[model samples]
Target: MSAGAPPVVTEIARPWWDALARGEVAVQSCSSCAGWVFYPRPFCPSCGGRDLAWRTVDPAATLYTWTVAEAPVSPHFAHLHRPVLAVAELGIGVRVPTTLVHADPDDVRIGMALTPVFDAGTYPGFTLLRYRPA
Candidate 1:
Protein backbone atom coordinates (compact mmCIF):
# COMPACT_ATOMS: atom_id res chain seq x y z
CA MET A 1 0.00 0.00 0.00
CA SER A 2 1.09 3.53 -0.63
CA ALA A 3 1.15 6.35 1.92
CA GLY A 4 -1.65 7.92 -0.06
CA ALA A 5 -3.78 4.79 0.41
CA PRO A 6 -6.96 5.79 2.17
CA PRO A 7 -9.45 3.96 4.27
CA VAL A 8 -12.58 2.72 2.54
CA VAL A 9 -15.02 5.27 3.89
CA THR A 10 -18.51 3.93 3.69
CA GLU A 11 -21.64 6.07 4.04
CA ILE A 12 -22.14 4.95 7.62
CA ALA A 13 -18.60 5.92 8.60
CA ARG A 14 -18.43 9.27 6.80
CA PRO A 15 -19.54 11.26 9.81
CA TRP A 16 -16.88 9.77 12.02
CA TRP A 17 -14.22 10.49 9.40
CA ASP A 18 -15.55 14.01 8.97
CA ALA A 19 -15.29 14.57 12.69
CA LEU A 20 -11.70 13.36 12.65
CA ALA A 21 -10.91 15.87 9.89
CA ARG A 22 -12.29 18.60 12.12
CA GLY A 23 -10.01 17.61 15.00
CA GLU A 24 -12.77 15.92 16.92
CA VAL A 25 -13.39 12.32 17.79
CA ALA A 26 -16.74 10.60 17.86
CA VAL A 27 -18.31 7.17 18.18
CA GLN A 28 -21.65 5.73 17.22
CA SER A 29 -24.17 5.28 19.98
CA CYS A 30 -27.58 3.66 19.96
CA SER A 31 -30.25 6.30 20.49
CA SER A 32 -32.53 3.64 21.90
CA CYS A 33 -30.19 1.50 23.96
CA ALA A 34 -27.50 4.10 24.79
CA GLY A 35 -24.83 1.59 23.88
CA TRP A 36 -21.58 2.95 22.46
CA VAL A 37 -20.28 1.61 19.16
CA PHE A 38 -17.10 1.85 17.16
CA TYR A 39 -16.30 0.95 13.54
CA PRO A 40 -19.63 2.52 12.67
CA ARG A 41 -22.53 0.43 11.58
CA PRO A 42 -26.22 0.84 10.91
CA PHE A 43 -27.52 -1.14 13.85
CA CYS A 44 -26.72 -1.22 17.52
CA PRO A 45 -24.75 -4.27 18.61
CA SER A 46 -26.35 -4.44 22.03
CA CYS A 47 -30.02 -4.03 21.14
CA GLY A 48 -29.98 -4.37 17.34
CA GLY A 49 -31.55 -0.94 17.09
CA ARG A 50 -31.36 1.16 13.96
CA ASP A 51 -31.62 4.48 15.77
CA LEU A 52 -27.93 5.23 16.08
CA ALA A 53 -26.33 8.62 16.39
CA TRP A 54 -22.86 10.06 16.15
CA ARG A 55 -21.69 11.48 19.46
CA THR A 56 -18.47 13.29 20.24
CA VAL A 57 -16.43 11.53 22.85
CA ASP A 58 -13.63 12.56 25.18
CA PRO A 59 -10.17 12.00 23.66
CA ALA A 60 -8.88 10.61 26.88
CA ALA A 61 -7.93 6.94 26.90
CA THR A 62 -5.67 4.40 28.53
CA LEU A 63 -3.20 2.20 26.72
CA TYR A 64 -4.45 -1.37 26.81
CA THR A 65 -1.73 -3.02 24.73
CA TRP A 66 0.91 -2.10 22.16
CA THR A 67 3.72 -3.32 19.96
CA VAL A 68 6.69 -1.78 18.18
CA ALA A 69 6.94 -2.35 14.46
CA GLU A 70 10.61 -2.51 13.67
CA ALA A 71 9.65 -3.83 10.28
CA PRO A 72 6.74 -2.54 8.29
CA VAL A 73 3.61 -4.63 8.34
CA SER A 74 2.75 -3.33 4.89
CA PRO A 75 4.37 -1.17 2.25
CA HIS A 76 2.41 1.89 3.36
CA PHE A 77 4.18 1.78 6.68
CA ALA A 78 7.65 1.22 5.26
CA HIS A 79 8.45 4.91 5.59
CA LEU A 80 8.23 4.69 9.34
CA HIS A 81 10.92 3.08 11.43
CA ARG A 82 9.98 1.45 14.68
CA PRO A 83 6.49 2.87 14.87
CA VAL A 84 4.42 1.99 17.88
CA LEU A 85 1.05 0.42 17.21
CA ALA A 86 -1.34 0.46 20.11
CA VAL A 87 -4.81 -0.27 21.32
CA ALA A 88 -6.27 2.17 23.77
CA GLU A 89 -9.43 1.82 25.80
CA LEU A 90 -11.37 5.05 25.60
CA GLY A 91 -13.15 6.63 28.54
CA ILE A 92 -16.47 5.24 27.34
CA GLY A 93 -15.07 1.70 27.11
CA VAL A 94 -14.30 1.49 23.40
CA ARG A 95 -11.00 -0.02 22.41
CA VAL A 96 -9.39 1.79 19.49
CA PRO A 97 -6.62 0.49 17.29
CA THR A 98 -4.31 3.46 16.88
CA THR A 99 -0.74 4.51 16.41
CA LEU A 100 1.17 5.94 19.34
CA VAL A 101 2.82 9.18 18.33
CA HIS A 102 5.66 11.10 19.92
CA ALA A 103 6.47 8.27 22.25
CA ASP A 104 9.35 5.91 22.79
CA PRO A 105 8.48 2.27 22.59
CA ASP A 106 10.66 1.49 25.60
CA ASP A 107 8.75 3.86 27.81
CA VAL A 108 5.24 2.80 26.90
CA ARG A 109 3.38 0.94 29.59
CA ILE A 110 0.01 -0.75 29.86
CA GLY A 111 -2.58 1.57 31.44
CA MET A 112 -0.68 4.73 30.49
CA ALA A 113 -2.90 7.78 30.02
CA LEU A 114 -3.25 8.95 26.42
CA THR A 115 -4.70 11.79 24.37
CA PRO A 116 -5.75 11.87 20.73
CA VAL A 117 -3.71 13.31 17.86
CA PHE A 118 -5.26 13.58 14.43
CA ASP A 119 -3.00 13.48 11.38
CA ALA A 120 -4.58 14.72 8.17
CA GLY A 121 -1.49 14.91 6.01
CA THR A 122 0.54 11.77 6.38
CA TYR A 123 -2.12 9.51 4.96
CA PRO A 124 -2.99 11.85 2.07
CA GLY A 125 -6.72 11.42 1.50
CA PHE A 126 -7.68 10.50 5.05
CA THR A 127 -7.08 11.72 8.55
CA LEU A 128 -5.58 9.27 11.02
CA LEU A 129 -6.54 9.29 14.69
CA ARG A 130 -3.58 8.45 16.88
CA TYR A 131 -2.64 8.73 20.53
CA ARG A 132 0.24 9.94 22.61
CA PRO A 133 1.21 9.91 26.26
CA ALA A 134 -0.90 12.32 28.24
Candidate 2:
Protein backbone atom coordinates (compact mmCIF):
# COMPACT_ATOMS: atom_id res chain seq x y z
CA MET A 1 0.00 0.00 0.00
CA SER A 2 3.06 2.29 0.29
CA ALA A 3 4.13 2.21 -3.35
CA GLY A 4 1.87 5.13 -4.12
CA ALA A 5 3.23 8.55 -5.09
CA PRO A 6 1.54 9.88 -1.97
CA PRO A 7 -0.70 8.65 0.83
CA VAL A 8 -4.43 8.45 0.03
CA VAL A 9 -5.46 10.44 3.12
CA THR A 10 -4.50 13.99 3.88
CA GLU A 11 -7.75 15.61 5.03
CA ILE A 12 -10.24 12.93 4.02
CA ALA A 13 -9.50 10.18 6.58
CA ARG A 14 -7.42 11.68 9.38
CA PRO A 15 -10.61 11.92 11.41
CA TRP A 16 -11.25 8.18 10.93
CA TRP A 17 -7.82 7.09 12.09
CA ASP A 18 -7.81 9.65 14.86
CA ALA A 19 -11.06 8.12 16.06
CA LEU A 20 -9.11 5.00 17.07
CA ALA A 21 -7.32 7.08 19.67
CA ARG A 22 -10.71 7.45 21.34
CA GLY A 23 -11.73 3.75 20.85
CA GLU A 24 -14.10 3.11 17.94
CA VAL A 25 -14.12 1.23 14.66
CA ALA A 26 -16.32 2.02 11.67
CA VAL A 27 -17.04 0.91 8.13
CA GLN A 28 -18.77 2.78 5.35
CA SER A 29 -22.32 1.59 4.95
CA CYS A 30 -24.18 2.49 1.82
CA SER A 31 -27.56 3.92 2.59
CA SER A 32 -28.63 2.88 -0.89
CA CYS A 33 -27.68 -0.81 -1.01
CA ALA A 34 -27.37 -1.43 2.70
CA GLY A 35 -24.00 -3.12 2.13
CA TRP A 36 -20.93 -2.74 4.32
CA VAL A 37 -17.78 -1.43 2.69
CA PHE A 38 -14.21 -1.37 3.99
CA TYR A 39 -11.12 0.78 3.36
CA PRO A 40 -13.52 3.66 3.97
CA ARG A 41 -14.32 4.74 0.50
CA PRO A 42 -16.64 7.63 -0.32
CA PHE A 43 -18.97 5.52 -2.42
CA CYS A 44 -20.60 2.12 -2.38
CA PRO A 45 -19.04 -0.73 -4.35
CA SER A 46 -22.09 -2.90 -4.83
CA CYS A 47 -24.49 -0.20 -5.87
CA GLY A 48 -22.21 2.71 -6.73
CA GLY A 49 -24.23 4.91 -4.42
CA ARG A 50 -22.89 8.30 -3.43
CA ASP A 51 -24.87 8.28 -0.22
CA LEU A 52 -22.61 6.58 2.29
CA ALA A 53 -22.10 6.98 5.99
CA TRP A 54 -19.84 5.63 8.72
CA ARG A 55 -21.45 3.01 10.91
CA THR A 56 -20.07 1.47 14.09
CA VAL A 57 -19.76 -2.33 14.12
CA ASP A 58 -20.01 -4.63 17.10
CA PRO A 59 -16.29 -5.47 16.96
CA ALA A 60 -17.37 -9.08 17.14
CA ALA A 61 -16.70 -11.47 14.25
CA THR A 62 -15.69 -15.00 13.38
CA LEU A 63 -12.58 -16.75 12.06
CA TYR A 64 -13.88 -17.53 8.60
CA THR A 65 -10.38 -18.42 7.45
CA TRP A 66 -6.74 -17.76 8.41
CA THR A 67 -3.04 -18.53 7.91
CA VAL A 68 0.10 -18.59 10.07
CA ALA A 69 3.13 -16.37 9.41
CA GLU A 70 6.12 -18.72 9.33
CA ALA A 71 8.29 -16.31 7.34
CA PRO A 72 9.38 -12.78 8.11
CA VAL A 73 9.63 -9.95 5.61
CA SER A 74 10.89 -7.11 7.84
CA PRO A 75 12.34 -6.55 11.29
CA HIS A 76 9.06 -4.93 12.19
CA PHE A 77 7.44 -8.28 11.55
CA ALA A 78 10.12 -10.42 13.20
CA HIS A 79 9.65 -8.82 16.59
CA LEU A 80 5.88 -8.89 16.39
CA HIS A 81 6.28 -10.67 19.77
CA ARG A 82 4.19 -13.63 18.64
CA PRO A 83 2.93 -15.43 15.57
CA VAL A 84 0.05 -13.80 13.76
CA LEU A 85 -3.35 -14.86 12.56
CA ALA A 86 -5.28 -13.31 9.65
CA VAL A 87 -9.00 -13.94 9.46
CA ALA A 88 -11.91 -13.12 7.16
CA GLU A 89 -15.59 -13.96 6.82
CA LEU A 90 -19.32 -13.47 6.28
CA GLY A 91 -20.29 -11.04 9.00
CA ILE A 92 -23.61 -9.40 8.15
CA GLY A 93 -22.72 -11.25 4.94
CA VAL A 94 -19.84 -8.87 4.33
CA ARG A 95 -16.36 -10.35 4.18
CA VAL A 96 -14.53 -8.44 6.93
CA PRO A 97 -10.87 -9.15 7.67
CA THR A 98 -8.75 -8.54 10.77
CA THR A 99 -5.72 -10.03 12.46
CA LEU A 100 -6.41 -12.72 15.03
CA VAL A 101 -4.85 -12.53 18.51
CA HIS A 102 -4.76 -14.19 21.95
CA ALA A 103 -5.59 -17.67 20.66
CA ASP A 104 -3.35 -20.67 20.18
CA PRO A 105 -2.94 -22.22 16.72
CA ASP A 106 -4.68 -25.37 17.86
CA ASP A 107 -7.43 -23.38 19.49
CA VAL A 108 -8.29 -21.45 16.34
CA ARG A 109 -9.98 -22.74 13.23
CA ILE A 110 -12.24 -21.66 10.43
CA GLY A 111 -15.84 -21.03 11.54
CA MET A 112 -14.77 -20.12 15.08
CA ALA A 113 -16.48 -17.01 16.44
CA LEU A 114 -14.15 -14.08 17.07
CA THR A 115 -14.40 -10.58 18.46
CA PRO A 116 -12.69 -7.32 17.52
CA VAL A 117 -9.83 -6.13 19.69
CA PHE A 118 -7.87 -2.87 19.57
CA ASP A 119 -4.21 -3.87 19.59
CA ALA A 120 -2.19 -0.79 20.44
CA GLY A 121 0.85 -3.07 20.27
CA THR A 122 -0.10 -4.10 16.73
CA TYR A 123 -0.60 -0.52 15.71
CA PRO A 124 0.89 -0.55 12.22
CA GLY A 125 2.07 3.07 12.26
CA PHE A 126 -1.62 3.61 13.01
CA THR A 127 -4.26 1.91 15.07
CA LEU A 128 -5.25 -1.51 13.63
CA LEU A 129 -8.26 -3.77 13.96
CA ARG A 130 -7.63 -7.25 15.33
CA TYR A 131 -9.78 -10.04 16.64
CA ARG A 132 -9.82 -12.67 19.36
CA PRO A 133 -11.75 -15.95 19.60
CA ALA A 134 -15.22 -14.88 20.63
Q: Give me candidate 2's TM-score against the actual structure.
A: 0.75
State in Å the error of residue 11, model 2.
4.7
Quick one: best TM-score, which candidate? 1
Q: Report the number of the highest-lDDT candidate.
A: 1
lDDT tens digits, residue span 22-134, model 2: 56766678899898877677778899998988766666676777877777545556654445567556356556656677878777788888776765554344666677888
Clashing pairs in 2: none
Q: Score every model by TM-score.
A: 0.93, 0.75
Candidate 1 per-residue lDDT, tens place, 1-134, comes to 24736788999999988999989888999988899988799999898999998999997999999999988999877888899999999999999999999999999999999988888877676888999999
Total backbone clashes of candidate 2, pairs 3 or more residues apart or in separate chains: 0
Tell me the number of clashing residue pairs for each predicted model.
Answer: 0, 0
Root-mean-square deviation of every model = 1.8, 4.6
Count backbone clashes in candidate 1.
Answer: 0
